[model samples]
Target chain A: MRLRLTPRDPSYFDLFAAQASYLVVGANLLAEILGADRATRKDINRRMAEAEHAADDATHTIMRRLNQTFVTPFDRDDIYNLASSLDDCMDFMDEAADLIVLYKVDELPARVSDQVQVLQRAAELTAEAMPRLRSMDSLQEYWVEVNRLENQADKTHRKLLAQMFDEITDPILLLKLKEIVEKLEDAADAFEKVANSIETIALKES
Target chain B: MRLRLTPRDPSYFDLFAAQASYLVVGANLLAEILGADRATRKDINRRMAEAEHAADDATHTIMRRLNQTFVTPFDRDDIYNLASSLDDCMDFMDEAADLIVLYKVDELPARVSDQVQVLQRAAELTAEAMPRLRSMDSLQEYWVEVNRLENQADKTHRKLLAQMFDEITDPILLLKLKEIVEKLEDAADAFEKVANSIETIALKES
Candidate 1:
């Protein structure tokens, strides 16, 4: 029997890259929120919300294209997973920022900034790697490095939690800080998930 | 153009229901852990881990079948998402149990049990709904009710947080309890996600 194959559309890669770029914007916004004074947090949060919305649109575009195109660059499931994972990263980041504003957290441990830094590096790596998905080449390092970064974030998370319990006295303040830190840690975890989805696609195609 | 259709396999629905069954076991195990004394905590956690492993196996079977089968009951992405979301619910439950063990949390607030009850009900609803996915009929109520249960879980989560800050004086204990509660909340959230995936599939297929 003869097999029929539809022509591949490369625009999916563009959309993926665009979505990853939103993660970068989101990471930067998170880092900024960590450093910004209380006076600026509201504005920073608004910007983060905007970034999250932009990422959502990018995800919708990918999904819409998947429905319209008979053939995708990779498995349709991989595309959907990648898009959702990227969206999750932004969502957690936005949630973290919102928590800070909602909780009116005045001070954060330095380790929170450290976690955001890990997120920034992972976001950069993700943005760089999304375009490489078209060929599925040199993408293994992207995921491996992301896994390492997530591990680093995990260590920082544990240390921060331990320190908070050991040093923090006020239960209310501890609650606020803990929620923010966990969300940042979750963002890091979401980034690793995105990388894992990309790696899965690579393995399946290769 | 002539469209060729492949027959849908019903085994997938079986696997999904089996996975949901593990969730029921897990929810009960979580409730047991919450109510059990320290002496039985280890045993309960072990049981939870086992349930999680079983759910993982079910998820793997679904994925393997998805790779081998040409036609599925619904979109392949929806199948994968539903399976993963169910697996995630178990993972979070296991994590919460493990956290209780790891933190050696002496006593939990009564509301923790309330959250687990919501999870139990949602799990039951999910198990009942997975079989109906084959026909995509009467599944709407399953997801809508799950969403309501998740909202209920959210209120309990916030109330527990408030109580932790208000009544719990020890910073260390508060931190431990908060993490466990959040994980439980996350499990509830994952269940709703599974329901949402099912609902999406139902809408698309109908």
Candidate 2:
């Protein structure tokens, strides 16, 4: 029996992972932005906005690769979906930060900060997992860890929301906190989607 | 150049569309379940719970088609992304309804109901647009209409959320309402994703 490998060139998956890594950096920046005091809202949100643009650029490169290339290091659909999934994660982060700026939130909620930390961790795990995708032997192990991180993030998201409802007395603050928590949850879900896509790639490879 | 006049089989797209239509029906059922009397919670939520199984079935069929078929009616990546987007919409709706059942909300907020209706309309447009993918020329108008409907749904979602924050008094109720509205907004976003995918297909044909 002969094993066939997908022909590779510019390494879309690698570029995609770099973008995912940038998203994590953006998440960290957002965390810092939220924690920072009395800074201009524009300055705080800039990192997140740039992250969104970077993700989009990666997605555009992915589309071009899919169109012009005959072979990929991964499945064509997987490449596109993974790019979009990472983009979705950044999109949520950017949206959450944008909301904070738009609403002129004075103080960052501790719960939101915790969820962002989890998201940063998850994004880092995702970036780590991407290179191993080229080799089928290690895909399962990375995906399991990714899935575990996502589950942990989900638990944090639920707990944060529950606490937000319990402790927050102001209606506007409650709404803002809930939005931030849910945005974090959505971003976590996006990460999970990438993990699931990786699972599919594993299935395809195996 | 001779146009490829061969009519590819519609069974795949047809089945896919039918399942999406069922999901919309399920969304309506959820709206009804959420709005039902407390006495009916057990029965209505149970039925809504069952929709997950049905959605899974639809998803399985779509995935199978994606795996086995090479020349899809549309771009393979678009088909895959659109399928997952539809599934996500159903999943979010199901998750929100499950939350309602678990939280034991006695009465439905009018805003949640309004958002659900918008989602239903968007889903209907999706089901309508699916068959047109088989013959892009025939569905050009529908594609445009679906995009317009998505725009309408987006406006409704934003306006509804604004009103939700403006009118709701209790912090707890405000949290629940925000979650429900956000879930519905996501459903609308999923529909818009599909609409955008179709427009991309239309562009290819034109």
Candidate 3:
């Protein structure tokens, strides 16, 4: 066992970990909003906006540090990409939450909960994985698990799409539900992107 | 007005031009299919697939060359981004054409024709812009115009969405048209991304 003596700024890991933590907040909020009443959902959406803003701030901090700092723990491009993808995860989840409130849909399909659960799991994995970037140990499991979860999310999304088309009768309601589900799917894709970025970074380091 | 010898690969521009030209083929096919009967639309979609395949090959050529070459005309990441965005333009347009055929919609709202027309013009502008990367001359107009066109397309899309909800009563038909329009809108966004990438490369060179 050895301590890293290189002058790499160790705080980039902390920054990334901070940024990823918001994903968990945003995802959990998304899960909460789905089970909420209309008034409660509006309140949860307000909280989601705050969480998104916090995530955005965390990202800006990383970018600012990147701009000023000469050296980084990884390739600057990879850092930028990882940060952007993390922000995307928050943005997509926030959009899903916002749309649910804006569309005033009384209920989402049961499969949507399945979609949100995948996001929550992916977010937790990402949060856990970020701190490990410095050590770069056991990262293979994190990315591989996230990838598997994303595939599951994708299957759920297609089924939900087909099911909605078959069962939903009102075009306007159908439009609202379709858009909301798609946003959740986008969030899932964004999570996969983050995992892929991590995999590239880990492979390069190794 | 003098050029000293630099060992930058000249063919990257040609590769990009080939890719952008497919967007024109794609955008034009999208426009043509909007006017064609179902039989002809199917044929146009077949041709669109061929154009998309050509575009994919062009992107692969660039990627292969990028991996092999030491010096690029611009930043390697910028080149990668520009190529990816160009590919996105083709993919989104191809998807729109495919969905139009798959959905078997008899008619699209007239504004959708306006959307395709915007894509056609943006594609032409992009094809024209590719050659100018060498000099980085007069690129301001290309990106600026593409941004303006994207804004217009966004407005058109929102209006179209509102109108569809207000007018269309059939849920199935609404889903088909909505998905198709969103794909067209996504194509417009992808074209704007290409322009944005070019803008970055030009700014760095300037």
Candidate 4:
């Protein structure tokens, strides 16, 4: 088989990596928000908001590049989807953090941390994979790993939901915690969507 | 501007129209579920499951056609995003319906029907727009109207959430209703996303 090559800018990869890095920042801040005292959660929420804005900027840059360039390293739609999905992951994390503050919840379940860990790991994998997208080489492992993490997150989410309904008695507190957990699960789902988009690109390019 | 045309299949438009029609079916079923007695809610939920499944098939068909066709009526990525977004709207509606059943939510706020009405209108506009995709003409009204409906849905959603937190005292019931409301809001958000995708396609294609 012959190798097919196309003229494309490497900067798209740089922008994608930059965007994935924001997910890491957002996830860590989410973890901080979960573990921080009520006094400190406000500051963490502010930082998460800033991270989400930065991610949004990266997404816009990618979109601008997509419009100006005729030939891309991969499918234009895949690039758009990947960038949008990464931004979505950050948005969900921000939403989860914002809800914590908005609802004024003082306590969280231990499983919240478990889900954050999955997010952090997935973000790391995503950051590592974005640069390798230019070559489309050995990228299958990235998506596979991300998929596995998402599955683990699903299980953690189910367990947390069950525990929340079965154990929590305070009505307002239960409502707040359930929203937070659901947002975290949404972030996890968004990460898997990013992975799926990458897998689609790899399949078409390879 | 020069008129540039690519050879494309028209069947993809049919599939999109078919998918949008499912949203109508799902929306109507949701309205029924919201208004019906508990015994009838079960039957409505079953019908919703079927609509969701049918939407999934339409989505898969679009994807398969995307892979097989060379040139498309619009950007291939737009095609994928439009199909996926339509499917997502249905999925969120299905989730909301299932949650009502899963949580055994007895009474829904009046505003829930308001949001469903918005969804129904948006679905009708989307179905009407899909056929016009072939010429990419007179499609602007569809997205514009859908956007207006989405804004109305947002207002209804906010009002419902405030009402729930302000008046609902039962913890478990509060949690259940909040989840249901959030999912409906998400479906509205998804519909707006579909509209946004269509707007993008119109701008690019026209």
Candidate 5:
């Protein structure tokens, strides 16, 4: 319902929504990889990598459009950051998947599944939030929840680290688990950053 | 001497230079920690923490000024990113030192020092480059050298990982060392980001 003298394209919202949708796919692929057998994990990881590449392509398209577009929905840097952080979510998830296979980790601790569940939940919330960017409606709730979830994820990460050091016998295995868990933690932080960027954009718009 | 209609503040350059100087101090502290005994490293770490807090205060100042000032010399987000990446360099170096003492590791790999050396050089180059932002001169060489150094650091990082995995028998020690090395790598990447940000700012100005 807003009228502007300059024409502002809205497809950027669609592109963001599309980009976020890949995160949902990537997070789900991560969940699937966590449960599958070794052979099955390799297969799932391949899918995750493909999803990551797709996200990468999506990010490239957004950046290219940003370069060509004159008037943007928000600040140009915010768009770049939003796209980069969204890509970060996929990249961290993909890296977690890749390391799981590369290290040949047989079975992860139960808490890791807890970590992935957080990613899945965050991804769903993020995917749901993107389209709403068009309206900038009900975004406060989305960011608040993501912030809460990120805090939960942080506590879980620290406890998981302590638990791993306490229980895991082999140092090499502990190292592998720690790195993967850290990647998941990194992904969670990335999601939190995405929400923060949205909050900034919405605030400026309002 | 180009004439401008609007007033623009240039102290952001000085603030940035001040921030990069802390990096130099912190990087040298890390090198000192590598050579000293546990007690001495603790003493040095105390200084590093102080330096980090100083850098954090500088960042806070930059952000505050950015919010209050109507017109910045360049884009606001680029200033934010530049300040942030500079802070990241200090942060990772601080974390690296903190881990060294926290893990109580007796000795580090020589390549670990190699990693620190790279940081030292980058910090020096970055501090030198901050003042040049006023005129945006010779920045291309700065960023080009930084990119080249980052590539060298990346190669060294992978080799360090393989060597650690191959040589270190104690898994816990390996875990500690790996985390520290990775932090150093993160700092290196952060410097590259700083350089890249400068390049972006310079290009836009040009």
Candidate 6:
């Protein structure tokens, strides 16, 4: 779809898209971290911290843009919510990675990797969807697709959580894994918040 | 401070204040549920559900207002965030109450009541703070006090959880009580979010 030629540039939305892309990159780093042993765990955490910093930087950039740009590609409030929600996704990913690294978890739980992969994909889709918001067209279609992807992530999360509950023996392990899974799942939920807000914006515009 | 006229009429903000007050009312009902004995549990649950229904009505009212209003008394995004956060508090309280009711907890746990009471008071403060947004001219000082109360609630929550962990015996009881305390504490956290947003709004206006 061709981008709508609004009176103002869509730089704020572009910054938001970049923020989400950075989160996807962070999720990939987490996936890579799952393979590292104890010795490399610290280094992996350091790398994850760097990714978090990048996400934070993206957040500040979006905020600054929001302050300066009178005419946003989307609703000003939607831009703020989307920006913060993307940052939250990164924050959760960094936290999960930090816990694994700090606790010296014996092994990377399969569900952790799976959830990160789900988040990575969701972040990608969110980034892709942002540009489309600039166009005064076909947004409802994109909204539906994002909603479907979000629902898929939710289902995958619940399935993985049930699996984790069935397989884990130690109570501490169970609790930690439950938290990680819930956090990742919640990140997807947060993404859905952004999508829902975008839908609101689109409907209002139309 | 005199009430400054808002960008929108009194009805919109009045609805928000009413919804916030409704949540506080739900918190009180939740506290009552925590005080009930096992035999009287059914009655407690019924009252709690009634409170929850009222809270849901408040949420719907706020959402309708948000959708219809253009120029708001405060930042439109902040207004939405405040309403959603307040509704989330109600949702959590209802969930905890429902769980206890379904499980037929033998008696009111001290930790459960402790957290609920703190949450109840915090919600009250939040309800009080909501209307102050209408009068940015007069209630700037009240915003600070509300934040301090929220901070106090957080410290209380942490101390309560620590005491709960240290004092509780019976593994199953410990688990159940822990979840209840966490949910109730989270309700307080939601109140804090509302308070913080109000503080921000106050700062912007002042």
The candidate that wins on DockQ is 4
Docking class of 5: incorrect
DockQ of each: 0.14, 0.15, 0.15, 0.20, 0.15, 0.09
Q: Of the true interface contacts, what fraction does each candidate have?
A: 0.14, 0.14, 0.21, 0.21, 0.14, 0.00
Kindly report the docking quality category of candidate 2: incorrect
The parts of candidate 4 lying over 4 Å away from their true place are A1-72, A75-84, A87-107, A138-141, A144-166, B1-10, B35-50, B60-69, B75-81, B110-206
lDDT of each prediction vs. the true structure?
A: 0.85, 0.71, 0.88, 0.84, 0.87, 0.69
RMSD of each: 9.6, 9.2, 7.8, 8.6, 8.0, 7.8
Extract clashing residue pairs from model 2. none
Show pairs that collide, candidate 6.
B1-B138
What is the DockQ score of candidate 4, to 2 decimals? Answer: 0.20
Residue A137 accuracy (lDDT) in model 5:
96
Q: Write the per-residue lDDT of candidate 1 for residues A141-169, one digit (tens) a residue.
A: 99999999998998899788768876887
List where candidate 3 sits over 4 angstroms from the true fold. Answer: A1-18, A21-25, A28-32, A35-70, A98-104, A109-189, A192-206, B1-10, B32-71, B75-78, B138-167, B199-206
Local error of candidate 4 at A147, Å? Answer: 4.5
Classified by CAPRI criteria, candidate 3 counts as: incorrect
Scoring only the A-chain of each prediction against the true A-chain gives TM-scores of: 0.93, 0.87, 0.94, 0.92, 0.94, 0.81
Off by over 4 Å in 5: A1-11, A28-70, A75-81, A109-175, A185-206, B1-10, B28-71, B98-104, B138-141, B144-172, B203-206
- Model 4 chain A: ten consecutive residues of lowest lDDT: A1-10
Can you give the lDDT of residue B76 in candidate 5?
87
> How accurate locally is residue A62 in candidate 1, as Cα lDDT from 0 to 100?
87
lDDT per residue as tens, model 5, A79-190: 9989999999999999899888877788999999999999999999999999899899999999999999999999999999999999988868777788899999999999
Clashes of each: 0, 0, 0, 1, 0, 1
Indicate the residue-level lDDT of A76 in model 4: 82
Residue runs of model 1 more than 4 Å from their true location after superposition = A1-10, A18-81, A94-107, A138-141, A144-159, A162-166, A199-206, B1-18, B36-54, B64-69, B73-78, B98-104, B109-206
